[model samples]
Target: MSDTSERNQAVQIPQEAFDWYDAYAHGGMDRRTFMRKLGTLVAVGYSMSVLTSALLPNYALAEQVSFNDEDIIARYEVFDSPAGYGKGKGYLVKPATGAGRYPAVLVIHENRGLNPYVKDVARRLAKAGFLAFAPDALFPVGGYPGNDDEGRALQRELDKSKVQNDFVAAAKHLKSHALGNGKLGAVGFCFGGYMVNYLAAVDSDLLAAGVPFYGTPAPKALRNNIKAPLLVQLGELDERVNKTWPEYEQDLQANHVEYHMFMYQGAHHGFHNDSTSRFDKASAELAWQRTLAFFTKKLA
Candidate 1:
């Protein structure tokens, strides 16, 4: 009856009990087997207090659970914006295993407007542990339906001033949200990429990182004002915007801006949008990995 022997006796569990409980918790065994093992542990003089602690629901347990359940779901829900701006509303895509105080990202949709691709991107960002918000940049004006033939039409309809205001408002809203970590970054595609660049110019104070995927080049005058670290993705074969990318790189270099410029070989515009056969899965995945890494380093 030595103290050490008594302590060891009290804490010991039969190997069968440990294996059964661990396997059941991890889904390798059934509940009946788990309870049978538990009964055995109690009979063997293990305290019920210990078993309760082991079996009780725990937040830490949720952390270890895989988000592989195919039936589990999450989606974007739009909340309010300031009065007077008809389309200042912001949408959030919450992860199924929701996090508190997660870092935030603002996703700016292309000139064709907010579509399923934009929402999917937001959800992917949320899955990566960011509080992702994709505000409708075209909402203040007439909403633009994405169409190949009408792409130019949609481009002509955007009101830059209002979009800028909406972006600023969205940034402020995300920074103050209850779930926000206050560290913010932005990602944009096509014309939205240009907006992301513009945001870096006007709202650098709030942004920790920026990624602009094939966005039009910003006016040279605004380059020096871009204070956040940026990652610019371009398609070398994109005839519409490829001509100006070199100058943009030069501007980034001259201003001593922290940036990464990636030119995808043989890729074209809209290469990152999965809905299109034009999507370059390899290049898009690489760019996405780079974007996520950049945000992790800068925003986390």
Candidate 2:
């Protein structure tokens, strides 16, 4: 690579993520597959190293939870997806010491399944006093299998409508859980963020609040169907997602939808994901804090 070429490459978000964002946003690919493609395209160099790091398991996902199991009652459970798509599996997390019903949060993961980072997000919610559950969107495909490429391939094969129904089912399950206080809220990142936007755009009685980080808007037609309050977070540097915001905002207002948005000046897509270089700790922390406040005010 020439000096100018190397400088340009270094200045951009990893070359690996160029197509990943659009693919994942459209529900066409997964993060693992993105990294794998990155590795293959750039045989040997710094690019290859980036690919390796991106695919590595983020075992140390959350700084707050520290993988501590005792703080919350965590387990795997099956939820029904009525679209004839079969059962859905997820990691259910709640305050271990809490007694009595608590507000429930549907924690949706990125395009990938319920990996460690997402599971830890659930734990973080648990710590904040919400009964959180992170569902594996790839459950029908034999689960995540700890491989991104495989996960993306499976994610692409999903029936979009049925998959959405599965997410709704997860919310319903949490709402009806004995540990739940009946109210429900949702939070999602990346692909999951789009899911959050989807839920908000749909007329679901099960959802009371939604927070989508760096996600696109719901389809233009569904804007009026939103009955729940939404706190949409955005990364200023994420052109793909941000580019649609203006039009989305107009539609939301025209429909009188209840929604709010926050954009971090220097943050890029996936800024809230702690596992990757894309993470912006300051912005992520602020977004999370705002989410907690939103859920507490709306769900509690």
Candidate 3:
């Protein structure tokens, strides 16, 4: 079958799925005015997804692709870095079907560590035509924290210098991979976002694009060294870091860098992680669309 036929066969959503959506809409907004406004928002979101999926070949292909843990082509491995983080490890997810050279993406995990969510992001990139490498930034620190409470405890013990070394090692490993296209990009969430910015600032030649979601901004002096196109997504109501994003954005503009900045009106810090209670579906979906487009334009 043709790719389009395959996609059409794979992308169908059952009619029953819409029933929950209908009930949620009816239950969430009692006022006609509120319901109308929400309905319009939902319509716009739906239209964007449909149009985007139809227009982008990668997006269409992504819809038809599925991955399971057992399907991983490259196994996880540990590496020694000169930056003193001994035995830093990373997971590599390669395309299951392709035989040719593929673009590479470096995925950095949030403070919570390299969990299933980070793995899913790697798999998504692979499906979209890139080989994804997600390094376990916490391996040197004796593994990532288990939960918010435990994560905080582990965070206090982490060595910043070691983490930087781990990132550098991860980037180098991805760049040297057999399947890697040698054109690399980086994407990070929360703490990983900060690392992405730092990597872009220090190792511009290693990355063609950088996407940081609710990440800490690089120092003003380092901004001049950023050689990659940057796409930053900020959450306006994020309790932790929203207050400083505007000033940071100004710094990017002052440096005359190519950048795209977006602020989701009421999203929280972890909005992109579906497992989080703070996950804002609308904002997350839009941010993801922007991310894929940005990577396609800059790295592809």
Candidate 4:
């Protein structure tokens, strides 16, 4: 490839552009507005196509572990959630060679539902010897639709309370599953991260541990109720989320909840998601190692 072509391929998206994408992805900004704002980057020599491609997630490039990997078993299964979504469905993966029960983890997705990236995360957890289940909050609305823009819209239509119930039900379901060893943990990113905090707060007995990556904090009233250990991950450049961290830390400490927080310098929100240009390799790897260690210690 020509040096110019290679340069274009390795183009570094400006942090401001990432802020725009993050707002759009989280519903604060509409697609038309986001794209129009991004178009301004063309004046600075960025092609619109390249800029768009860099911001949007390309799930094809995000898989770290495959669904059919020989070391793990992965499949879709339905679980009862009568009080929440009537019937919930999710991707479940577990170690293929393990005869004994494994510690369970509930993998929650972002607001866009149980997309491929989140399913891949479940597979990664299973590859590490944990029984992982990723429930689709969009199932009641017809599932993920294979497109994140559409998935986000579908998720917005659901009642937030019902969605929370669905995840709470998922935690209970995974904790009690036959293949689980009666210990349960959760890991979530962005919206999923908030769910992890919420889960830790709501069901102290059901969730033994949690990892929330750049998620919004649970309400202050609920923070004191959290008993499960938490490994909170954040990006230094994400002001929207980080602004709430101080009070959250105070709450956790005041309540004596066991926890540790990591702030990745120069990283932005969604740094752990490899499907986008915002992914910070060094931070993501270190966070994953810490996450695995935390789960291993607490789940055991």
C-alpha lDDT of all candidate models, in order:
0.68, 0.78, 0.69, 0.89
What's the alpha carbon RMSD for model 3? 11.3
Model 2 misplaced regions, further than 4 Å: 1-47, 50-64
Each candidate structure's TM-score, on Cα atoms with residue i matched to residue i, is 0.69, 0.84, 0.73, 0.96
**Residue-level lDDT for 186 in candidate 1:** 91
Collision pairs in model 2? 32-148
Where's the lowest-lDDT run of ten residues in candidate 1?
56-65
Which candidate has the top score in lDDT? 4
Over 113-159, each residue of candidate 3 has an lDDT whose tens digit, in order, gives: 67667767887777776788888777776665554335434554678
Q: What is residue 137's positional error in candidate 3, in angstroms?
A: 1.6
Which candidate ranks first by TM-score, i.e. highest?
4
Query: Which candidate do you rate higher for lDDT, 2 or 4?
Result: 4
Order candidates by lDDT, high to low.
4, 2, 3, 1
Candidate 2's residue-wise lDDT over 121-173, tens digit each?
A: 99999988899989998888889878555666678788888888898778778
